[model samples]
Target: MVSVTENTEQKIIDAACKVFIQKGMDGARMQEIADEADINKALLHYYFRSKSKLFDRVFVEIFSDIVKLLGEEINHSTEIIELIERMVNNYIHLIRERPFVPDFVLHELNRHPQLIVQQIHQYGMDFSKFQLLIDEGVLNNKIHYIQPVHLIVNVLSMCIFPFVAKPIIMGFMLNGDEAKYNQFIDERAGHVVSFIKSSLLINNPE
Candidate 1:
């Protein structure tokens, strides 16, 4: 059971995420966020002192969610292919659920690289386990030799690029058809998994 305070704080954060994504930090107002949260300005202020503070909180939470997802996937999967599949699928779903996140995060990252770097340090994102998995696969002749950083970057780029380039891909490539574009995105995980397996895994069955 969640406490009232926790619930209210989450409500504020959720509202803030939406507002910040739409209007951005410069355009968003505190009263607007309070209204979006369905709470009075005083109550919103009780939870967050200022718009800057609230934006920081929202940014940290969103970034933390991604880091946590990666950490969880790394811990749970035993095989390199399994980890890639899980990460690709879940990452796509996450972006779908919060479509505003990638754009907002990218903007913030450009403006405040230091803040994002601090969050990464705070989270202590360890990729050594993922590296070990890759090493194991290589030793067992399951996959080709690849550095963990390259693997990680490749997977992230494939997972995130579609969403980040939604306008071009959806507008031009998809003919501005949202339904078709959605279907494309929905089928993307399988495509990505297959591509990775075919490229990396020896004798991988199509």
Candidate 2:
């Protein structure tokens, strides 16, 4: 039950997203997006006043999608190790598919950090539950004592740093071979999970 107007708007948004992901804001052209959407540039401009406006729309949705994704996945579960594994794997897969989202988001975030605060307020994000889970794990001797913030930072760094530094990583480590770099990213997910587990889990001597 989609109206033609809404459908056309969505088509424009979809085409814009692809172009933005490929070339980012500076390089994305309205005519290119129009061609991709099979619409005329004039019609595209009618829907979105300018490329910046289109980019803003796409960027905001990307942020919202990421926020929703994190909110959905970070539900507190008893199986902390499994959760870590899932988190790492999910992020790597997502970044691999997009390949441009990580750097693009960070670049935009540097320009508009307040946008994140605004969305946080809008979403009423809750970290208290996850904090409680970490506290319980420490008390139960399930993992080494660590602050929730530190643990979160560590996990995110492991999951995100490689993707953020993809060009350098690929250039230096994989010798600019995209397939090799992709394989490295894929394998790094499991390695990160195991690395976190090893660091957090305490061994009791017999």
Candidate 3:
């Protein structure tokens, strides 16, 4: 039940995301985005006043989904290990679906760190539940004592680094074979989950 206007807007947004991922904000042109969307430049400009505005739209659209997913995972998971597994699997799938997201966000992080921080704050993401899970695990002797910050950062780094460094990883590790690279990415979630569990759980066999 997508209206024509909504569909057109989504088309523009999707086109903009692709161009931004490929050329980044500095190199992407409005006309190119219009061409990608199969729309006239005038219509594109009418919808989005400028490239920066369009870029912001794309970033917010993608980042908001990521923040939402993370917030849900933190809120709903009862155990730290379950949270870790869900986070790794979900995060990896998200990045794989939006392959340009990690690089775009990383670039923006360096360029507009404050803006990213503001968006996360606006999302109202609370880590108290995550920390509580960690503390509970430690108290129950199910996992080793570790700061939630460290664990959170470690898990995030592991999940994001592969996608952020995709080109290098694919070239160096998989000899630029796209199929094997994808397979590596597919297997990465389980590897990350196992690694984190091994580090945190006292009875981890792997």
Stretch of 10 with least lDDT, candidate 2: 1-10
Q: What is candidate 3's lDDT per residue for 152-177, written digit by digit as tens? A: 88999999999888899989989999
lDDT of 1 by residue, 1-206 (tens): 12354578888988888888888788888889889888898988788887778888888877887788988998899888899999999999989987777888888889877767778678787888888889999999888989899999999999998988989998999899999889999999989989999999987878
Say which prediction, candidate 2 or candidate 3, comes out ahead on lDDT. Answer: 3
What local distance difference test score does each model get? 0.86, 0.78, 0.85
Off by over 4 Å in 2: 1-6, 204-206
Distance from true location, Cα of 138 in model 2, Å:
0.8
lDDT tens readout by residue for model 2, 68-180: 76666677455566667767788878777776788888877787676577677867767675677777778888888777778777888888889889889889888999999
RMSD of each: 2.5, 3.3, 2.3
Indicate the residue-level lDDT of 34 in model 1: 89
| lDDT value for model 3 | 0.85
- For candidate 1, report its TM-score: 0.89
| Candidate 1 residue pairs that clash | none
Candidate 1 vs candidate 3: the TM-score winner is: 3
